[model samples]
Structure formats: structure tokens, C-alpha cells
Target: MTKFYSLGDSESEQKRLLRQIDLYGDTRGVAFGAANRVVELGCGAGANLWIARQLSEGSYVGVDVRQGQIDAARRRTRDLGIGNAEFQLADAAETGLKAGDFDALFCRCVLIHQPDPRPIVTEAQRLLRPGGRGVFIEPDGPNHYMAPGKEALMKVFHARTHYAYGDGRGSPGAARNLYPLLVNAGFKDVTLTPHVIVATGDDADCCRAFLRHWMEIIAPVADALVAEGLITSRELKQALREAETVKPDLFICHTMWQADATR
Candidate 1:
């Protein structure tokens, strides 16, 4: 299996937390008051489960393929004295979880890494009870924006990074397929919502921080690109340097697609 970006690293963990806050904090009433069983697929470090705890009085189950992330999640829940959250090491596509048992299922930024997301969606449908809801969030890669001078280099970086995952078999633009996938998987009342992040002027610090975190996440991919003779070392360094130098007019728009449906 292809490895995800910067798994088990402090920087990646921080980025995950920031992303969770950015995505969930601004959106209100994400969980139902009556929800009693919730699950998260690819719940890296289980940050979202912690967030879910605040929204619903549910017992939470988080599943990830990485043992290291599972260990970290276990420690995090234990340290927080949360008794209702459980972490398991398992594949998202075939989690072996009970069928028709969960009240809600959530996944974020995970389906893009899969070469075919149908299995995961199918599994989600199976996992949810009748009238249960499923929420999925993923990036529409082609719509990602950056400052004028940095767009081309970042595009190249993204393309090379996508190629690194399963030799280009992964879908970098998986967000666009969420609606059709959910519908095809027998979900009803599917709805799509787009969340676009555009930072400018006073948000320069936030933009810089976001870009820096991305750089850190992709550093290993940059090294792999060089080793594969896909990009020159100097080119990678130049791109990194440009990302580090923030300008007042710096702007980036990342549009994430969120799809929700009932099983």
C-alpha cells in the first residue's frame, strides 16, 4: 500500500488539527442530538472523534490503517479521559465493522488517496443503519489556487505527488465524484456543499502557515520526485523557498467538496 503524506509526524498531526477546526468549527450542527453511534473512516489521530464527542452524546469508533496513528489516538483519548471513543487499526474499504449499526459515518480527505473509492462508499452504506447519514469531504484538486507565480510550480508538485501514490492511479480530484459515488452506492437524498478557503491581506499569516504546513507534508514527496528523476533538486528548493516567502497580496483558494446522504 502507498503511504500517506507525513503520517505520524508532529507537523502532520498539527495540520490535521488545524484542518479539523477549519472544516468543522465554522459549520454548525454537524451531528444529530439523537445520534448514539458514530464512526469515522481514516480518523488519523482521532481528532474528529474528539470533536464529535462535543456535538453528540454518542460512542465513537475511529478506524485507520496505520498502527502508529491508532496508538496515538488511543493515547489521546486516554489522556483526555474520554471513555466513549475507541480506535482500531483497519482498512477503510473493508472495516469488518457491524452492518446497519452506526447512526452516522464521516470521512475527510481520505477517498482521494484510493484508486477506486467505490468499495469505501459501499462499505459506508453497509455500515449505516436505515435513515443513517454519511458525510464525506474531499478536495477537488484541479480547483486549488495559489499566488500567481507559484501556481505552475505547485501544480507540478501536486501532479508528481499524485503520481507517487499508486503510480498515478489515485484520484487527486476525488471530491467531484462524491455525489455520483454516493448515489450509485444506493444512498438517498444526497447533497453536495462546497467549502472554499480564500485568504488575503489580513489573513497573510494564516495563508503562510497553511502553505508551510503543506510544504512540510510534501517534503518527503519532493525527495521522492528527485530520486525518481521527475524534478530537479534545485527546482524543489526554489518552490519551497517561494512558498516560505509570503507577500501581502498572497492568495490561495482550496475548495473542498462535502457530500451528505442517507442510507
Candidate 2:
């Protein structure tokens, strides 16, 4: 069965993920100092590959399902002269790597793509040594909102999310319920933190970038939604045009949750 992956493997998507790392890195709560061996599940294009630099005395491995992303990750790390990192093409839920081999595991924006995250959670637990730590960041899909009204954009978002929730894809709102999942999985020190992305007139460039990200999300899913009768082609065109014409004063806010646990 095929599922929808947001902003699929385009060269431009790689650049966008890199930019997203710059935008969200500071808040990522990854305790790199304590981690000697690290694994990043769903590590697209090595967006957070800089984590390798911080682990000068350690090693890092990035795993992703997309071969293009795995290849791009290797190329980017090699070209940038960043070492101590390896990229593997594998499904996050079942990476064929050794069990209990890593001391720390990090996942960002991965669970939202999994309709059932339990398998991935189990995999994370199995891969970590006793007392090993894991940090996961996932967006709060149902709660993301924009202010000052762009009804068309909202409609597109609704269509996109609704479509995503179908066809074996996971819910965008999966992050909020992670605590119980981790606890039930026997992970200790389970913690949840909420982070918000606020793009307003105060941060003009950031706001624009936020808008672009929002529109880019729609582009990939628009056709799927149309085919499913969730949206019309004309609606997609209008939404994209409105997205481009969004004013500098536009206000959009999104929320993501960070889950920290120990095996």
C-alpha cells in the first residue's frame, strides 16, 4: 500500500528541510552531550546532520525510507566535510540495525506519517540500550492555525489533512497523545513539551518562510485530494495564488510536541 509523504523527495524539499533545521534547531532539546551513539529515524536529507559535528567523540546514524534522501544525506555530509555520520535507507519502524546498540535515538516529524506509531516506538525501544534516551518531535496537526483569515488556505489545509488521515497514513495530531504511548511501551521518564511556531509581522522573513512552507505542503497533496473528491483543481490554483500573495503582516501559528523517554 502506498501512503502520502509530505513534500516528497525533491531536491528542493531537501533544501527546505535544511532551512527548517536552522529555524527549529535551537529548541530541539536533544541532549547531545550525554549521547555517545545516536540514531535519527526518518532523517530526511540529513537536515540535522550538524548533530554529527557536535558528536566529535561519538557516532551518528541517520535512517530514512527514501533512497533519494539517503543518497542526498550521504552526499551532503561528504561535501560539507562532516564526519562520524552514516546514512541508511530503511523504514523507521523496522530498521534492520542491531538491537540495544545505541545510547540515544532522535526522531523529528516522523510519527505524523505513521498511522500506527506503536511499531516505531517499539523499534526505538529495542534499538536502545537500557537507560538509553530518546527524543521525538512531532507536529500537532489538528491545532495548527493562521490568523487574519485566508479561508482558501484553510480549506486547502483541511482537505490536505483529511486526505492524509486516510489511506494508511497517520494523523497530523498524533503528537499530543505520545505520553501514554511511551508509558505503555515501558519507557521511563516520559515527558512532553509543547513548542509553538509563531510567524508574524515582527519577523518578516520568518513569516514569509512559514507561508512558503504552508503552500509547499499543499502542492504535493492537492492532486491526491482532487482525485479523492476532497478538493477541486480550481480550488488548488486559487489557494496557491493566495498563498503567494500573502501579505508580510500575515500571522500563522503552528504547534509541535516533543516527547522524551528512556528505555
Top candidate on lDDT is 2
Q: lDDT for model 1, on a 0 to 1 scale?
A: 0.74
How much is the lDDT of residue 173 in candidate 1?
62
Q: Judge candidate 2 at residue 205 and give its lDDT.
A: 78
Give the Å shift of residue 257 in candidate 2. Answer: 0.4
User: Please, what are the lDDT tens digits per residue for candidate 2 over residues 1-263?
Assistant: 11667678899888888887766543455667634899999999988876787787999999999999999999999998987999888888889999999988998888888878888889999999999999988887677787565677778887887677645677566788789878988899998888887778677677667778777777777887789888788887777776766565677878888988999
Query: How many clashes in each structure?
Result: 0, 0
Candidate 1 residues lying further than 4 Å off, grouped into runs, are 1-20, 23-29, 151-153, 165-168
**Candidate 2 Cα outliers beyond 4 Å, as residue runs:** 25-28, 247-249
Q: Every model's Cα RMSD, please? A: 2.7, 2.1
List TM-score per model, in order. Answer: 0.88, 0.92
Clashing pairs in 2: none
